[model samples]
Target: MNKRGQFYLVATVIIVSIIAGLAVISNYSYEKTPSKFYPIEQELRIESAKVMDYGIANGKNTNDLMKNFSRDYSINSDSDSSYFVFGKEDNLTLAGYNELNSTTIQINVGLGEQAMNFTKGQFQAFNFSNTGENIKVIISNVSYDFKLNKGQNFYFVVSKNIDGEKYVATNL
Candidate 1:
């Protein structure tokens, strides 16, 4: 009877230890897992792209179009935030990140035949062209100037940067 009781006690201890170990492992994995912000980010990107498409197709004014679109929709959620900025630096770029998927997404809208190179720091530069229409856009407290011409061909350049957790989207 003593041996049987000891065996039962030992078995219970082993089961309890296994349960505790599993709980610890689960907690660790939950902490290490990335957030599920990619779906929301992708939705924002698609909405932004749709807004751009509609604005370009209908020949709407950049400022009014963006303002109206933004009024009806927002890219922010409880866990994430985003903003859309339209700029004319010989081309247009819509860039942001998907934290859940660990990817950086960039969508380029070109209004001219000539290709343009844009760097991260170039977001601060505002050079207005003399010939095309110059317009100002504000998103998340950042302002940009876009020069565009009517009847110009538009191009799209889509790119993705992986491992995007290091990049945080700032309100400004």
Candidate 2:
């Protein structure tokens, strides 16, 4: 009887110790893994693309389009302390970083047969057009010249880079 009791006690102790060890290991692993919080960069990219699409579809002039876009989407560059660069070549690219998330997004808007393509990481693309001449619009101190012509195909690509983490925007 005494030997059996001792054997059961030893078994219980070993089982408990193993469970505790596993718990500690799991906790350590959880702490080591970084949590994916809100994707602020992706949100900004999507909104920026939406603004561009809206402007292109509505036939709003450059100034009005920019004004409406800025008004609708309130992105305080001063408060965020971020710089957005809008470049226009064969395509229009909007690139900026948000200090809060430490993430950067580059959105490219191409016209007529996908002028600009992103080969770096995953991205979401959108295409829209209007029947007019090319117009230049300034948003947040960045100028974007959109070639809006009749039956022109405008492609918008949103790509995000966060600490070497890659993700695709579901809503393009």
Candidate 3:
């Protein structure tokens, strides 16, 4: 090979080696487990209401369960002491396909105090996938109970409305 050709071949080989090394490192460090928080029983109990819904709706309820959730969970701007849950569920079934859509569940809990505001604010990122649709629900800030020296527990719920039929509540 000519001088220029030899230099070009060497450069190409070096570039390929660097790229291959980076690819191997990236694949090795890839995360297999998802990131999440599984609260202790103490903390989980405080948010039992929300937790119950998740268990029941997914047919995980071995115990007798009777809980009602509104389609939308909302709170008043002035006072967060009280909140409202409202929404509609729609179902679509044809042939062997089935889907449910829940629309508009709002949550406004607590007084929106500094701590509550921060805690509840994280609810914006809470979401679920249902029947090929993405449903968003806001958990109220008031749903949390805090204790000194102990980690706080917060509860929240969301639902979506499909075209017409009622969708079952699944997760909180």
lDDT agreement with native, every candidate: 0.42, 0.40, 0.29
lDDT (C-alpha) at residue 107 in model 2: 30
User: What ranking of all candidate models by TM-score puts the best one first?
Assistant: 1, 2, 3
TM-score of each predicted structure versus truth: 0.37, 0.34, 0.21
lDDT of 1 by residue, 55-144 (tens): 778987654555445434432343332334443544333432222233222222333322222333212111223334543433323444
Better of 1 and 2 by lDDT: 1
Best by lDDT: 1
Could you give me the TM-score of model 2 versus the true structure?
0.34
Candidate 3 whole-model C-alpha lDDT, 0 to 1:
0.29
Q: Worst 10-residue stretch by lDDT in candidate 1?
A: 121-130
Residues 74-168, model 2: lDDT tens digits: 24322222323222333323333233343333233333322322222222122233322454433223444555443312322222344575332
lDDT (tens digit, per residue) of candidate 3 on 1-172: 5999999999999999999999998888553321122222233334445545565568663122211221112221111221212111122111000112122233222223221122332112221111122222243222322211111122322222334432222223
lDDT agreement of model 2 with the native: 0.40
**Which candidate would rank higher by TM-score, 2 or 3?**
2
Give the clashing pairs for model 1.
none
Distance from true location, Cα of 117 in model 2, Å: 31
